[model samples]
Structures are given as C-alpha cells and as structure tokens.
Target: MANHKSAMKRNRQNVVRRERNRSNRSRLKTLYRRIDEAIVANSPEQARQALQNAVPMIAKAVNQGVLHRNTAARKISRLTRRVNAFAQNS
Candidate 1:
C-alpha cells in the first residue's frame, strides 16, 4: 500500500516497467528457442539467421537495462559458439 502520492506514482511506474521487462524476457526466450529449434533441425542457414536476429535483440535488452552486460555477453557467446559448431558440423 503506497500512502504517499509520490510512492503511489513510483509503484505505478514499477508495475509498468515490470510488465515491459517481462515481455522483453519472454521475447528473448522465444528468440532463443527459435535458434535452438533451428539447430536441432540441422538447418545451418536458419540457425545462423536466428542467431543474427537474436544478437541484436539481446544487445537491445542490455541497452534497455533489462539484462546485465555480462549476462548478455555470455548469452551471445554461447549462442554464437553453438551456431558456429552446428554450422561447421553440418
């Protein structure tokens, strides 16, 4: 319960931000899954494209403060490695 007017406003802002962050996270998950599915299907081109699309969105998440810089870097690194390995093997 936010009794103060400013506190109430802050709470409202938090709710909005929370929903936005959740949506961003959900989108990230979907992007990740797309890459994984492409890899599993052994479609190197699709996997590469998915990685290309995902990298920018991941960076955007970091820029938006939805994800930490290090976390974003780790995710990009892992996904890149997976895609590269899959491409090389295929």
Candidate 2:
C-alpha cells in the first residue's frame, strides 16, 4: 500500500531483509541448542567443537548487523564459560 515508487522499493527490500534476518536468527538458535545439548550430554569434545563453530557464526552475525555487538559478545561469553566449565569438570 505504498503510494510512491521509492516506498514500494523500500518495502520490497524490507521483506528480503526480514527473511534473511529470520534465517540468520534461526541458525543461531540451532547452534546454541547444539552447544547446550552437547553440554548436557557431557561431551566436552563435542561441546568445544560446537563452540568453535558457533563463535565465528556469532561474530559474523554481529558484523552483518543481525545481532548487536554486546548481545553477541554476551552470548559468546556465556557459551565459552559453559564449555570451559564442562571441560574442567570432565
């Protein structure tokens, strides 16, 4: 329902960006779950590997502006802490 051509274009761009952001968020959640499950299963090696994969994906999300830098940093910090604790205990 955009009257102006530019507005219509902007709407289209928003739709595309929305889908991309949703996909990125979904992937992030999946990675987080994988890490959590690894930790719960008491597999330090698997958890560490998942953490390795997750950190870069999270940093990429921050760089892409899908996630705020602090939010991403906090997520990375918590995941790292969990993995480290699991490693130490195991």
Candidate 3:
C-alpha cells in the first residue's frame, strides 16, 4: 500500500532482495549443518570432505555480504581445526 511510485518500487525491490538474501542465508546454514553433522558422525574423512565443501560456500556468503569476513573466517578456522583434530585422532 505505497502511495508514491518510488515507495512502491522500493517495496518491490525490498521484496526481491529479501527473498534472495533469505535463500542465501538458508543455504549457508544448511551447509554449516552438513559440516556439523559430519563432525558428529565421527568420521574424520567425511568431516574433512564436508569442511572442504563448506569453506567455499562460507566465503561466498561473506563476499555476498550475508556474513562478515571475520565471521566467515572464524567459522572456517574453527571448522578446520576440528576437522584437523579429527583427522589426527583417527
């Protein structure tokens, strides 16, 4: 219910951006969960593989502004350490 034309256009643009950002964020969470599941499964090989897949997705999320660079880097670092530890233990 935007009375002004510009307001209506802005509303449409916001809807489109919201959908795109939501999907991107959802994908990031799903990827993160996959890595977590692999870690919890107690299979180092699977965990390492999942981390490999998740890292790029996380980086892309950062690049897209869905996540901050440090946040993504921290996630990657922690996951890498966990995966490395799992590999060493296994």
Runs in model 3 with CA error above 4 Å?
A: none
Model 3 whole-model lDDT (C-alpha atoms): 0.88
RMSD of each: 0.4, 0.6, 1.2
What ordering of candidates by lDDT runs from best to worst?
1, 2, 3
Q: Model 2 shows how many backbone clashes? A: 0
Q: How accurate locally, in lDDT, is each candidate?
A: 0.98, 0.97, 0.88
Ranking by TM-score: 1, 2, 3
For model 1, the stretches where C-alpha displacement exceeds 4 angstroms are: none
lDDT of 3 by residue, 59-78 (tens): 99888888899999999999
Q: What is the lDDT of candidate 1?
A: 0.98
Better lDDT candidate (1, 2) = 1
| lDDT, residue 48, candidate 3 | 82
TM-score of each: 0.99, 0.97, 0.89
After best superposition, candidate 3 residue 83: deviation in angstroms?
A: 1.2
Clashing pairs in 1: none
Candidate 2 lDDT for residue 52:
99
lDDT of 1 by residue, 25-54 (tens): 999999999999999998999999999999
Candidate 3 local Cα displacement, residue 82, angstroms? 1.4
